[model samples]
Target: MPLTRRSVMDAAAARFGWRRAYGTTTEVDALLTEQSETAYTASASHAELATAKNHDALAVQPGVLDVRGRILADVLYLEGVLTGARNRGLPSEVIERLEDVVDHGHELTVLLADAVRATAAAHTAGR
Candidate 1:
């Protein structure tokens, strides 16, 4: 199966034991769940506003909306993990890895934004 955000995050959760140093897996899970929900809500709201403002080109693209939401959620989750890892004073290597993950997540957001802009420009030009 293609890797969805949840799957990647689940793998991350299982792979990282850093959370155990500061809190139970259950606590980490709860934090992730909350962050994911918040991210999704924010993404949906932004999508709706964009659509209402005649920027529905990106929204209408196949799989783009879902990917955007997933990216937002994944970034939020990774940010939470990174924060926790720092607060717990995890080893430098682990902290570095978490930082990398967070940075990659931000990169994904930038790519998605570029896609959205390209789609919008194309749509406008075709009008």
Candidate 2:
């Protein structure tokens, strides 16, 4: 079937909201590059957000939205710390460790979101 207006709106809005709100495409890409394997979780979270099916799984997407928002705060804070440390010429090891912190944070948020979505989907199916 062809997509409805609301469906189209939902997909585009969900993606734009995540990128513009939690991260910018360019910034996140650069972070991942600088972070190497340390940015895996953030990269995964970004990938999950890019999936339109994930958005359509929930009616409003509030659960994932909240999870992402909360995580974004912590991730951004950690990134800031890493940036400061790097600017000060801190060791690459220390910066990588900071990126690890951000990675764990992103992992936590994505896991929570997945759990919430699973519960929500089950509830909806049971009804």
Candidate 3:
């Protein structure tokens, strides 16, 4: 299946042991969820913009560019978090899995941005 914000986030959560606590959760898990939610929201907004019928419609939409920006920021933050975890001596295997999640998240963010740009260009040319 294609990489997506949700899938990437889920992978990250699993790697970080999200919700595995019998009665509590760790900071890493909470951080992952928070970051993932931010990305998810941005992606949803971008998807809505991608459905615009014309450049003008997309242009007039508030925060159209912000969607991509937000996702990019989230990806970067997650990468930094992973790097810190690695530095703190997380198990090599777990770190590797988290790294993969970060990589896939980055890829999805890029793909989403590209798709939105392509949609906007197509709308512009259709005018």
Candidate 4:
């Protein structure tokens, strides 16, 4: 269930002729940049949410952190699909199929956080 670099690299090479000696470095570089950006964005959002010192700070607003997290999750899903498809040298149609199924696992994370914050607020107010 976990991802491995070797699997990703092997899949990419098998699909796209992506050998160190033969592949286009530009595509690989671009994919890595996108992935890193998504990860950094997600981290910043989570940090803001987790570092809040009081429940009030967490309430009365939609946390930018969760929105950012969802956006980043979507980006990561896309990156994985594109990287896998590119490595396999898949056709555009096939790549589109993969993209359709890419799972962005952030909605539930955001919902859970919201639920926790709401419970905390209700408890604080003696509800």
Top-TM-score structure, candidate number: 1
Decide which is better by TM-score, 1 or 4: 1
Residue-level lDDT of model 2, residues 1-127, one tens digit each, is 1236535655788887742232467655654565686667567776656674454445446756776887889798888988899999999997889989988998888777777778678768867
Query: Per-residue CA lDDT of candidate 4, range 5-123, in tens?
Result: 64576688879877443256675676677679989987877756656734654453455456657666776767786788879999988677656545434444556567667756766
* Tens digit per residue, CA lDDT, model 1, 28-111: 676677789989987877766656765456445546657887988988998998899999999999899989988988888888
Residues 29-111 of candidate 3 have per-residue lDDT tens digits of 66567779988987886756656743564553345456667878887988897999888998888788888888987887787
Higher-ranked by lDDT: 1 or 3? 1
How accurate locally, in lDDT, is each candidate? Answer: 0.75, 0.71, 0.70, 0.63
Q: Candidate 2 regions off by >4 Å?
A: 1-68
How close is every model to the real structure, measured as TM-score? 0.52, 0.44, 0.50, 0.30
Task: Give the true-structure RMSD of model 3.
Answer: 10.5
Clashing pairs in 2: none
Off by over 4 Å in 1: 1-62
Arranged by TM-score, best first: 1, 3, 2, 4
TM-score of 4: 0.30
